[model samples]
Target: MAERRMMLRDPGLQPERTRLAWSRTAFSLTLFGLLCFRGWCRDGNLFYGVSALISGVALTAMLAGWHQRHGKQFLSLSLWSVGALLLLNSLRQVLA
Candidate 1:
């Protein structure tokens, strides 16, 4: 069986702050994706547009999972995945 990673009760204010920070990161990713999309539209580059769209979806999912109180493992996975996606997207835009 998979190891359980959830707590039975609230872990205090630190977790709340971390959760809020995750939401903020999600919001920032959404905004950055939009900006990238706009630039893609202007430049007629499919790569930029597609990467941004993926980032938006990833971040949105993270935010949703977070608010629903998904287990810490799930939250960590989603956050890291979104962060990596955004990082790769940024790198591709810069290097291409």
Candidate 2:
């Protein structure tokens, strides 16, 4: 009988790719936040300002503790919250 062995590391650079993807996402969120701030400055919309603040805080938290066990959970929640905020803002703009 032959015993199977588990590999300690991924051979396909999955971890590196994942890290890069996350970095890109963080960069995108930063850009989105900046755009929101710009919108607030131009139109004085409180929602834009609040969205920018939330984006900044979420990005900070995600980056600060990404290696922790609960980091993914936090990331998921942050993404959903940001998405929801954007959706609500879009709906408001359309309705107004």
Candidate 3:
């Protein structure tokens, strides 16, 4: 079977902070994606708009998952997702 990647345990620990951080990252990605897409798509259909939409979906997915779970795996998933977005941003900057 595929390895399980997310968790949803209370763990009796503070989840609010973790959840808030994830929410912040998600919001940032949504904002960045929009900004980049707008800049890249100034002309009729410059493009990158599709990527902005995808990032929005990713942000929603991360928020939904994090809000419902607070475990190591959940944290890991959020971290990886945020990291991926950062990496993509770096790539865009370098490639541009």
Return whichever of 1 and 3 wins on TM-score: 1
Of 1 and 3, the candidate ahead on lDDT is 1
A best-first ranking of the candidates according to their lDDT comes to 2, 1, 3
Clashing pairs in 1: none
| TM-score winner between candidates 2 and 3 | 2
lDDT of 1 by residue, 1-96 (tens): 234544444568878898788778777777877876886889876666765766666666676674456545654564466457557867987999
Off by over 4 Å in 2: 1-12
Q: What is the C-alpha lDDT profile of model 3 across 1-96, one tens digit per residue? A: 234534555665667776677678777877867775785578333235545555665666676774455444654565466456556766876899
lDDT of 2 by residue, 1-96 (tens): 133345365678987898898889889989988998998899988878888888887788768865355677776776677678778988999999
Q: What ranking of all candidate models by TM-score puts the best one first?
A: 2, 1, 3
In candidate 2, how many Å is residue 55 off?
0.7
TM-score of 3: 0.46
Candidate 3's C-alpha lDDT? Answer: 0.61
Best by lDDT: 2
